[model samples]
Target: MRFARHRTDQGPRLAVLDDEDALIDLDTEPDLPALLAHDGRLRSAGEVALRTRRRVTPWAGADLMAPLDPPTVRDFSTFPEHTAGVVKMLDPDAEIPAEFWEIPAFYFSNPYATVGPHDDVEIPPGCALFDFELEVAAVVGAAGRDLGVEDAADHLAGFVVLNDFSARDVQFHEMRMRLGPAKGKDTATALGAVFVTADELADRRSGPSYDLAMEVRVNGELIGQDRLDNMAWSFAALATYASRGTWIRPGDLLGSGTCQGGCLAELWGRHGRDHLPPLRPGDVVTTSVELLGGTRNRVVPGPPRHEILPWRRP
Candidate 1:
C-alpha cells in the first residue's frame, strides 16, 4: 500500500494512491490503534478507501509537506564505493588511518526539515559545487532495539526517494576533523513527493536485486542512471544495525546513502571522472526511481526567506 499526503480545496488531507483514484481521509490510518477508539468515522472511511480503487486525481495535489516534518533523519555510509572514495575526496594522498575499516557510520538531520515537490532550494552563495544523490530511504513505524536478525523487518514502516544534496567545495575545505563528510553534505536534503509502504515491494529479502532504472537530470539534461538492487547492503539490514540499542520511533528517517554511480561524489571520487560539475542559479534538478516516483528541486542563489540579514537595520 502506497501512502501520500496532499492538499485539496478542503484543506490538507492524507490520501491513499490507488493508481487513478486516491482513497480519501487516510490521514489517521498510521495511528489506527489509537484513532479508532476516538473517531469511528476516520476508521470506517480509511477501511473503505483501502478496499477498492475509484476514479480520482492522479496523486498530484497542492504542495506536499515533509511526511515527517519533525523527523529524525540519519544518513549511513553503507556502500563500499563511499568508503573508498572518502580518503581521496577529502584527505587525498594523506596517510591512511588504521581504523579505516568500521562496520558503518551515520549522522543526524534536524527533525523540523520541511520541503516539498518543485520547491526552490536557495544555494548558499559561497558554495561553488552542488551535487545530487539518489537513494531509497524508509520511515520507522514501530520502536524496537537489540532486535534479533529474524525480527528485523517488522520495524519498517515505508520507503521513499531521498536526495542527499552536497556541496563538494565546502566539504573538502572545512572538514579537517576527519569526521564530517558534513561540510559538503549539510547544505540540504530532499525527501518526499511520496512514500511507498514496504508491502508494495515483494520479497525484500531475495533481491540480487531488482534493478529499477534510476535517472537524474540537471537543467533537464540526464546525468546519472542505474539500478538500486545492486547495493552492498539492503534496507532491512541497515535498519537492524542502526536500531541496535537506541529506540527508532515513528517518523525517524534512514537514508540508503548514494546508490551505485548514484551521485557525482561516488563516481568522480573513484574514477577521477569529473563527477561534480557545479550548480548555479535557476538550475532544476530532478531525480526518479523506477516503479516509484520522481522528485525535483530547483537551485536559487540567496538566503532562505526566513533568514534575517544582520545589516538589515535594527
Candidate 2:
C-alpha cells in the first residue's frame, strides 16, 4: 500500500492511496510512524480507511509532507561506483579503502533537519558549492538489535526517495581534519510525499534492491540517471551492519547514499566544475525513484556564518 502524510486543518494527517490514486484520509492514524508502530495494524487500518472513504482528496492537490520525522538517519555509502568516483575526484591515484568493500559504512545525519518532499531547501551558510544527492531511503517498521542480513529485511516498513543535500566546500574542509561532514550535511534532507510498502516492490526485486530507475534533475534538465540495482551493499546488509553494536528502531531511516553521478561533485569530476556550476539560490532540484515518487526542492539563501575565535597554539 502507498501512504503519505499531508497537511490538513487539524495538522499533519496520514492518508492512504486508493485504487483511484486519490488520498483517503486515515483520520484515526496520526502519521506513518504511528501507523507502523502499531505492528500488524497497517494493512487493516489502510483497508478500513479505504472502505470508509472518509475524506478523499485528489493526489495532485493534496499538500504533501514528509512521511515521518525520523528518530535517526544513517546515510550509508552503499554504491561503490559513487564512492570510487568521489575518491578519484579527491585524489585520482587514491584507491578506495579496502574496508569499504568488507562492511557498509554510514554517517549519522541530523533528523530534525528533515524537510517535506516539496519544501524549499536553504543553502548552507557560507556555502559556495551546494549540491544534491539522489538516493533511496528505507524506513524501519520494526526494532531489532544485532540482526543478520536475512532478518534485517523483515524490519523494513517501506521506501521513500531521499535527497541528501550537501555543501561540498564545507564537507571537504572538515573531512581534511578527518572528523566531519557534519555541518556540511546537517543543513537539509528532503524526504517523501509517497511511501511504498515492501510488497509494492516485490516483483521488481533484483539482487538485494528493487530494479528501480533513479533520476535527478536541476531546473528540469536531467543531470543524472541510474538504476537502484547498482548499489553494491543491500539495504538488509546496511541495516544489519548498522545494528552491529546498536539498535534499529521504528521510524529510523537508512539512506542508500548518493547514486553514481547523482551529485554535481561527481559530475564535476567527470566533466569540469567550470562546465557545471554549483547550485544557486533559485535552483530547483528534483530527485525521483520508480514507484516511490519524488521530491522537488528549491534552493534558497541562508544566514551568514558567524565567526569564532581560532584555537591558539600553546
Q: Which has the greatest TM-score?
A: 2
Backbone clashes (count) for model 1: 1
- For model 1 the local lDDT of residue 134 reads 76
1-314, model 1: which lDDT tens digit per residue? 55556655665556566656443446344432123223234335556676743324454444564444434678865556555665465546634344433444567754443466566776754677777777767776666777665676677666778877777776777666666765467557776666666666665434623457777888888877767776566666667777888867666677777766666766566666465567778888898887667679988886643543677776
Model 2 residue runs over 4 Å out of place are none
TM-score of 1: 0.79
Q: In candidate 2, how many clashes are counted?
A: 0
Give model 1 RMSD, 1 decimal.
Answer: 5.3
Q: What are the runs in model 1 whose C-alpha is more than 4 Å off?
A: 21-23, 27-46, 50-57, 60-62, 82-87, 91-102, 181-183, 203-205, 208-210, 271-276, 304-314
The TM-scores of all predictions, comma-separated, are 0.79, 0.97
Per-candidate count of clashing residue pairs (backbone under 3 Å): 1, 0
Candidate 1 clashes between residue pairs 3 or more apart in a chain or in different chains: 171-184
lDDT, model 1: 0.63
